[model samples]
Target: MNPDATTTGADAIDEAIASGNDFDGSPIPQAKLGLYHQVMGLEAGRQRSGVSNTMRSRIVRIGAKHIPQAELNQMLVDADFAPLKDKEIAFYYSGK
Candidate 1:
């Protein structure tokens, strides 16, 4: 069996979110969908520095929601990306 054939727990949840659906299979709110599409469209058109920079951006954007600052910082360092900047720390961790 291919391990990727079945997704469970958080992986399934992430897939659902990426599909713009809820656990019950209902569509996400139109307003949120609209905003998401708008942002993603902008992101698609934006010029990227490179794959590593894009990876770092994604890590900062999504990891901040799930990982503690210290752990996320360590992960970035281990990945050979620069540590979080002051603005990122202020914006992402300031609410805690």
Candidate 2:
């Protein structure tokens, strides 16, 4: 599977926020959380399929570019959002 073709978890969160849907006071919408799970599942599948860290980094970079550092940090802090792995965080900040 091509990791590049898959939307990153960050992108999903961004889209969810952009949708203007009510979240019942939650920072993230259910749809966005679902998409984040899906993206992580795809990443795990890619790992199982032997995708390299280099590729993962590239994918993270691409997604991170779409979001500002402050917003990304806020998303990371949201209780409803899954935190990214350290390497993914590193990759994201590296691209910022």
The most accurate candidate by lDDT is 1
lDDT of 1 by residue, 1-96 (tens): 223434555477557657777766678888987897789889889987999888899899999999999999999999899999999999999999
Against the hidden true structure, what lDDT does model 2 obtain? 0.56
**Residues 37-92, model 2: lDDT tens digits:** 78877976774533455544454466577777666656655634444567767766
Clashes of 1: 0
Candidate 2: give the clashing pairs: none
Task: Point out the worst 10-residue segment of candidate 1 by lDDT.
Answer: 1-10
- Candidate 2 stretches greater than 4 Å from native: 1-63
Model 2 TM-score?
0.29
What do the candidate models score in CA lDDT, each in turn? 0.84, 0.56
